[model samples]
Target: MKKIKLYRPIENFNKNCSYEILVNGKKMTDLKNGEEKVIGISNELGKLNLRAKIQWCGSEKLLISESNNIEVIKVTGNKFLNRQMPFAGGLFPLTGIVIFSGNSELFKNIGIGILILLLLGLIGTLTIWKSRWLKVIRE
Candidate 1:
């Protein structure tokens, strides 16, 4: 038998929320804030699946590994960039467009075009963020 420990520290996001633990897509237990649990697994060597979900918000985080013994599974909510970058990137270009509109005619068009391109890039980043097509790299 293999044993693994799963722990979640009390954080602002998940401090008061109940976390549902799943291993290999099976319900393990409900963990409260600052709780830890040890789970046993079979000796088979395959992909080990781990997931955690906040009960109230239904937000989830997942981690998969080839090793059987995992020390901790931190449940992180949506990242700041994932939530705010869309608005920031989208709005920043408008300011430039307004500021440069009164400049020389040729320069004004160039500025507006550049700002439009930035808006397009913002839209593309937002699309990727919403669909979750890009994988988040955790340090």
Candidate 2:
């Protein structure tokens, strides 16, 4: 059998908590923050399903090459879209309303419409977040 060396470089965002490593749905080892370990596996010529998850958040998965090709596996924090987008969206319409505040009644009506649209945008943002549309970049 051969051994595979997987290097997990820790970052500040992920260094606070230990990561649970899983191989093919089986718990393998617990990796401490900033710790590098050489993970050994069967030398069989097949793909390996590797997963790593922090304590509080979701898991990130990777597919190891069937052959001995990769030498280093860098693990980093999972990036998510900013949660402040909803607030920003809501504020944008309010800003427009403030700018359009005038003596004309029609202007006030239009502002109300914009406010409704802002609420819709906020709802959409919440939906997007709940659906896990955020993309994870693997280093």
Candidate 3:
């Protein structure tokens, strides 16, 4: 599997337009108008570019004609990286509350919500406690 970055140079691409990508003189499949990805392999080292219409934003995966032969390289934009959340010290408490408040009876007539809540609460508490104790011992 190889990673290749693709750039679109067209202005205002319509979602209904077809795009083409070629690799190593082999004509690749025409990308669907709403397609976000088209997989292709590179035999020579050059500008591996793609011509496609801009589809809707925020879609994660794209289907390519040569999906088996091509691997789509993920371009890590700032917007993508910024979505990661920092390790919160509140995970246990928040999860505990959620489990305790959620409808566990929905799982069955048996009241499993309390059990799940307790389990999550225990896990969260243990995690927080371990972290705090580790810090104290380190200090």
Question: What's the lDDT of the predicted structure labeled candidate 3?
Answer: 0.37
TM-score of 1: 0.46
Please write out the lDDT profile of model 3 over residues 1-139, one tens digit for every residue: 3444443333232334543444433445554433445343543445434322122211223333433344443322122112221233335466555556657745333335555655665565445432221000000
Per-candidate Cα lDDT values, in order, are 0.57, 0.58, 0.37
In candidate 3, stretches whose alpha carbon ends up further than 4 angstroms from where it belongs are 5-13, 38-139
RMSD of 2: 5.8
Task: Indicate the worst ten consecutive residues by lDDT in candidate 3.
Answer: 130-139
Candidate 2 is scored at a TM of 0.51
TM-score for all models, in order of appearance: 0.46, 0.51, 0.24
Better of 1 and 2 by lDDT: 2
> Global CA lDDT of candidate 2, please?
0.58
| Predicted structure 3, TM vs. truth | 0.24
Off by over 4 Å in 1: 44-46, 56-70, 76-139
Candidate 1 lDDT tens digits, 1-139 = 6666666665454356666766666777877767777777665846656566453233323455555555555444455544555467666666576647675787667667777777787776545444232121222
Error of 1 at 26 (Å): 0.6
